[model samples]
Target: NAGVTQTPKFRILKIGQSMTLQCTQDMNHNYMYWYRQDPGMGLKLIYYSVGAGITDKGEVPNGYNVSRSTTEDFPLRLELAAPSQTSVYFCASGRNQPQHFGDGTRLSIL
Candidate 1:
């Protein structure tokens, strides 16, 4: 079974464009999160959900959004993508246990 999966491993978006980064897990986790890491910087939480239909904005939620509609899916949407939003995006899920992360999506905005 897949622990966690993210689509579009790499993408290039023009400024003002938008896209949704897909994330899904088969582990039936209750907690899910989205984070972004800039070059040489630590990961900054973008958004998170403790369960389906319950989501909260994280440290750097600007320009991004997330929705958790099921135990297995948490999708991150980037609205009007900007150059500053260009970074590697990671999705993670877990219960009370340690989180498992997705491979990551490398996004570049030009």
Candidate 2:
């Protein structure tokens, strides 16, 4: 627990099945992000990476998918699993602004 850390905080899918929501950040700062909090609206970005192999795609990347290679992992791939993708997933970082989340991952799909 140095900054960002998320694991099976909670999950439940059955529409298609496929999970991989794990993010790590030792406060190295490298512009990393991944958001999805649909319940009232606000966070939406789905994938983002500014280091380690590099990656991009925000504002909801379809079923979702992401990776960052190093600088403290950054995984988030949800193939299938519908039901509007449930919601409640946050993993972020920063290096020149604001961003620091993790403590969310409540997914549910029936």
Give me the candidate number with maximum TM-score.
1
- Point out where model 1 deviates above 4 Å: none
Query: Per-residue alpha-carbon lDDT of model 1 for 1-110, expressed as tens digits?
Result: 78999998999999999999999999889999999999999989999999999999989999998888898999999989999998999999988433899999999999
Model 2 misplaced stretches (Cα beyond 4 Å) = 1-4, 15-20, 27-51, 54-66, 69-73, 80-110
Poorest lDDT segment (10 consecutive residues) of candidate 1:
90-99
Best by lDDT: 1
For each candidate in turn, the TM-score is 0.96, 0.32
True-structure lDDT of candidate 2: 0.86
- Candidate 1 local Cα displacement, residue 13, angstroms: 0.2
Report, for all candidates in order, the number of backbone clashes. Answer: 0, 0
RMSD vs true structure, all candidates:
1.1, 11.6
User: Model 2, range 7-93, lDDT digits (tens) per residue?
Assistant: 878988899998999989898988888888998889888888888879889877998888788978999989889999998998888
**Global lDDT scores for all candidate models:** 0.92, 0.86
